[model samples]
Target: MKDLLIGVDIGGTTIKHGIITKEGTLIDKWEIDTDITNHGENVPYDIWNSIKTRLTDLQIGYDRLIGIGVGAPGFIDPISGVVAIAVNIGWHDFNLKEILENLSNLPVYIDNDANIAALGENWKGSGQLVSNMLAVTLGTGVGGGIIANGQILTGTNGTGAEIGHMTVIPENGYHCNCGRTGCLETIASATGFVRVAKQWIEEGKADSLKVRLQEQGNLSTKDIFEIARSGDESTNQLIEYILDHLGLALANLAVTLNPAKIVIGGGVSKAGEQLSKPLQKSFDKYALPRAKEACEIVIADLGNDAGIFGGAFLALQKS
Candidate 1:
């Protein structure tokens, strides 16, 4: 029988799983809404059942399955398969690997979602060229993973590349979900853009976005981008705010890590060069000369499937 691998990406609101061949093609996959309200203790069983049902539906025998690789949102101990903490998922000191191994009777591997995303990019997507690169994901919040010499640099406590929580501006900025002020995510993330825009709209600033949001119901970060494209004054200002912070953050990372490249992924990156242009300009100005010369920042080649491919890479390595 041909060998198969299982890759899971767990998020705050959904759990995405996929089956893949050794070549990194996603053969089949599905997503389930995560009910974190039940607390983190219940996540493993839910994941186990989900996988079991999928396997049964595919009619794949257990012997052909090699191993399972999981990417979850939290500080994970990859060696022990324990999640030290996940504020969004409500998990603390949870034994994820043990539960999955016991349920499926298969070997399991786990790591933070950002690390897995970087692995995904490295395996079949953007980072294939360079050995040292940083993958920064601009999701609901910012998540990052650092890779050096084709291996994840998860630092002590498996939480090294917590770039989102890094302080960009020292004394003045909004509070982040991680209980810090002036975090990169507080200004650069999807939620942050909307927060800044909504406040401006509520203040009755004159712009097309206010009219658009009033008609389109709830305003998303994407909506802000759309309005900016159409020449909305307030929307343009919001994009400027985001680009300034995002560029400054990248410059800071560039100076410190000096990675060969910076691969940007996640939903907000969909803005493409509209976002990248200003960000690149800012990096050119702010980053050190050698650091800027050493690195090339690019959009992630893989779209939503980076996580799946990354997870499959993890599984295949184990097999």
Candidate 2:
């Protein structure tokens, strides 16, 4: 009986894998470093090989597998399973489903990374059972997935709910990975925040945070948050700037969608209250009274595993 499912979450640095049941229970999970070498030409094979090794070790027969689901960064054509562009993963017009299907000989499905995270959160995380919700991921880059009327909103080209690409700065903004300028991702993402911090320090804002950042070469979001909590004026100010933009963008989306819950996920969200409180305040500042009152902001319960669960959810839909 084909009762098992495979969930794969592809990121720039890592690829998370999971074994799931059709009922959405996570059976087991693991991860591997993403090999972005040669435009990630070996990624598909690597994934299949790892799955094969795991299955062999677990003594799970191939017949027990139902299908595979994938969550990848960047633009995707879910219907055709073509990755239009995942710059971080070095894939362009890549036939992800085809390659995986050819390798694993199982059915495959794919969606934007953020969309799956939203689905996962809706299914088993903080946003569970919510009919209307928004899921945002703050990582190396910001990504969003919108749920309206209990359905993931994939625009005509399957690019709906792309909150990160929204233009926050019309001019003189940092360049975005999406070939745009002043995107919310450039301000709200960890990369963006660090970039701005470094720029500020280099531009003559002498501070303890600057010294720490310089000493560490690249600082994690947790490090930055810790410093902010310690009352590092520069770090706190940068956090404020980022939350302001994030809040404003989420506020606009909130009014338009009237979602009941806005779920925060991804690595950066690990800062917990330190990040959420000010973000909520910023959100309240920009959101309509009714919308703000109606919505509840919550941290994602799944942490990094949200994507894996989301992939499972996608596969279960087909199963």
lDDT of 2 by residue, 78-108 (tens): 8999999988889999999999999988999
Clash-forming residue pairs, model 1: 120-310
lDDT, candidate 1, at 199: 74
RMSD of each: 2.2, 2.1
Clashes of each: 1, 0
Model 1's alpha-carbon lDDT is 0.85
Please give the range of 10 consecutive residues that has the lowest summed lDDT in model 2. Answer: 204-213
Off by over 4 Å in 1: 199-206, 213-217
lDDT of 1 at 98: 94
lDDT of 1 at 296: 90
TM-score of 2: 0.92
Tens digits of lDDT, candidate 1, 1-319? 7588888899888888889887787779898888787676777888889888988998888887888889988899988999999888998898899999999898988989999989898888878747889999988889899988777888878988999998887897889988879898887888988877877878877367778778988788888888788877667777886788788888888888889989999999999987888789878878999999999988998877777777777877766
Model 1 TM-score relative to the real fold: 0.91
Local distance difference test, candidate 2: 0.89
